[model samples]
Target: MVFGFLTSRRRAGLRAQPVPPEWRQIAERNLAIFRRLSPADQEELLQHVQVFVAEKHFEGCGGLELTDEIRITIAAQACLLLLHRETDYYPRLRSILVYPSGYTAHGEHHVEGGIWEEAAEDRLGHTGQRLRALVLAWDSAKHGALDPTDGENLVLHEFAHQLDFEDASTNGTPVLESHAEYLAWGRVMNEEFEALRSAEDAGEPTLIDQYGTENPAEFFAVVTEAFFERPHALRRRHPALYERLASFYRQDPMRFVPIEQERERL
Candidate 1:
């Protein structure tokens, strides 16, 4: 089949070329999230990153030009989500569009008196457009990768949206490994979604971003930011949600880090 041939060719590419020194240096310099992976995951992630960079197109917007730093940095952060999982290389994703900073998109929104109006919403990043393009703010993306514990990564957040959209819907649920897992996913996620909604309604603080309360779809994207960036804090705050994410991502990120970095040094 064509799929098998493409996959075989991809494997051949990864084997044919070791990650270039320059790309490796760039990845090492930028990926604090990379340190949060186990050694095996880290190595595998590098391979995936290489494939991703080669496969996806990177285009600049707002007069910002593309460079290796931009490509590798985005590729490194984006591919981390695919680590430890069999993936189709974000089949829906075709290209990345980078803006120098926040960009505006025209859309309808309710303003004064709850009247609908056309407005321009400035965003750090956006996805869900035709051609499966992801638009990111370069500075935001870099700064997010620089601070691993902030629990907000533009790249991770958008890529999470990509994963969720793979099902032809933007629901919070991703495809699980088994039917039972799907049932458990619905139960646990709905319970947590309700809790978050309650917290928001009561004007109480939530460990996850308030944006997550928007809907199940946004909840999945927002928690993905927490799951990878603030694993320890997420575990302390919402143990069940953290457990489900860890189970789904196959990563106990808190345990994978600092130790992995130390081992790399030894």
Candidate 2:
């Protein structure tokens, strides 16, 4: 009875919520950045952006202040990913915490050498802490969104994690619609994951970011960044994985490939 009531209330809330004119304009403006997306995808993304901006609290972290420009800008990129799916694609994320700049936290051990080191605070991996949802360094997020090829958009990377964690643990595996799809997804992802690992091991320049080799979850996040920002390269070099992502993301990024050189390679 409780679950039913909550469900009904949730449905009512969704129904009561209306899209605003300003949100529509924001979506339309951001859509130009992703020219490869189809008209359908654009429309769908616009809706998701509208819903997300309305629902989530965009708070600035650290001492930095939040602004409407920052909130809407971040929402635009995060909502771009949902163009192919509905708002339910990111049910886990309830807030987007922003920081004026990157902040450091305490680390486990001070590795003065490979072995025999006392525990001391280190600066590495300090960004992994998630005291709040969707943490972003203001400058980092803004620059990353501005420069698509820079490979460090905090908005895209963090929001990608939220999407990956939609139905299960943040284990780099997302919930599929069917068992058969799951089986195929595992096989393909594992194979490509190993390929990425191998490339990183040999110090070979990988088209995908090396941070992807950190783990499966990071792999999913980093690959997602590539999927949206450098679709042509990802599809050309790793067509199978790209196809699976297209299926998962419900968007055919290949349709929007603007780089002639990248298309030629594919």
Candidate 3:
């Protein structure tokens, strides 16, 4: 794909700066999956993180103050989604509002028959509908990074939502490179979506969380978490699902080896 460049690829127009040594240490210390990547991928991720941090505005909420550690950690996770891809740095992203932990919000949703439903929910993260900004829980984001096999990650999930929303909708589909890709996506995703819905209804053991059956948007976000955190499990039990996600993300988390090596490296 002519989508973009990597430092290892050394493609023209890509001038990746060196990742700061201190930030490197912090990433290695806090992010397990990051260390599982090859050094070249690590360098790619670092440069992307630099771009993300430089471009995005991050404001701490709930009296929490921003710091390099928090910014680097979140930036590293967010940029991981952009690794080895052509991106405009989340073009519609305006800012990131992060709380120290899960926060509450009162909102309404569009329901069937054009009715509006009001509800209050506790959320770890949410993407903006107005193309303005996104929200996150720093504690959950940090926890998500520290563990790589939990099948839950706020950053990956939320950023994946951002990817989906580039089209101004959260319908479990992102922009595809081709129409053929779109056909393939619907085939794979719809089949998996129905299967997950059935599993949830039967209360069957599922590699996908029951929450995924809530809707296609939630399915995309939930699977994003599984694809990164529990790659092996997702691959083992849902190979087709894993394949589709790998194709979209343009990277395979399962291909990286020695899951525990990242923890031991420090």
Candidate 4:
């Protein structure tokens, strides 16, 4: 109890601190979505960013140097998930490891019965329930930040995994507020998951990424990317899925201008 109280106090203090000019500048320059947020949401995000930056450790891997720019940029995106919601700041996540670009991850894969093969795969980001860490490629992270409408975001994808991990399982469903909410989430998510899988099997174009068909967990993460980055398209194609995400996230991203339209204005 004492520890929890102290941690909350510390975070409250961090959130209350004034936003450093450099931090503000870094967020504005690197996070395009930050520019589109309402004033209230922007302030909420900055506060979350402050607490997240103070709590999470960031390390640059593969000979890259870590900077405030990188830290703030990543934190801004991760905290974007926390906006307008009660949050523990991705309670299970502790460290963020960033590489200069896509890095090779080596692991063992099951090739057949009782046999495993070692393999290396290039990845932009990764997170798992046991790891308590997020791995990201800085270049991809920057690109995702710069192009928030792209429907793919490294930080958001991995952090969605982090949220999935919060319930002690990496299932498509996070911790919903009630049993009724859980029922709704399961029904909608299962239907959408099956739809995506069927679409993939039939070779039809899909708005929710074919990768979501990998499993329920990846479906959650992929839809989260679509929820934030391609809200209108997701809503148009899958209203129930979009409504579930908006209810869970407590943010209706359709309020923001489409990036294409914003570019046309420029």
Answer with 1 or 2, whichever has the higher lDDT: 1
Q: State the weakest 10-residue window (summed lDDT) of model 4.
A: 257-266
Per-residue alpha-carbon lDDT of model 4 for 1-266, expressed as tens digits?
12488888998999999999898898889998899898888898999999999889999999999999999999999999999888888888899999999999999977889999999988999998999899999999999999878788888999999988888988888878889899999999999999999989999888887899989999999999988888877887799999999999999888874745422110
Clashing pairs in 2: 36-256, 61-98
Candidate 3 residue-wise lDDT, 137-249, digit = tens: 99999999898777778898888888888777778998788888889888988999999898878878887777888889889989998888777777777888888889889
Best by TM-score: 4
Tell me the tens digit of each residue's lDDT in model 1 across 94-142.
9999999999988888776869999999999989825489999999999
Candidate 3, superposed: residue stretches over 4 Å from native? 1-15, 109-119, 257-266
Say which prediction, candidate 2 or candidate 3, comes out ahead on TM-score. Answer: 3
10 residues in a row with least lDDT, candidate 1 = 257-266
**Top model number, lDDT:** 4
Candidate 3: residue 246 lDDT (0-100): 92
Error of 1 at 236 (Å): 2.2
What order do candidates take by lDDT, descending?
4, 1, 3, 2
TM-score for each predicted model, relative to the true structure: 0.90, 0.78, 0.87, 0.95
- Collision pairs in model 1: none
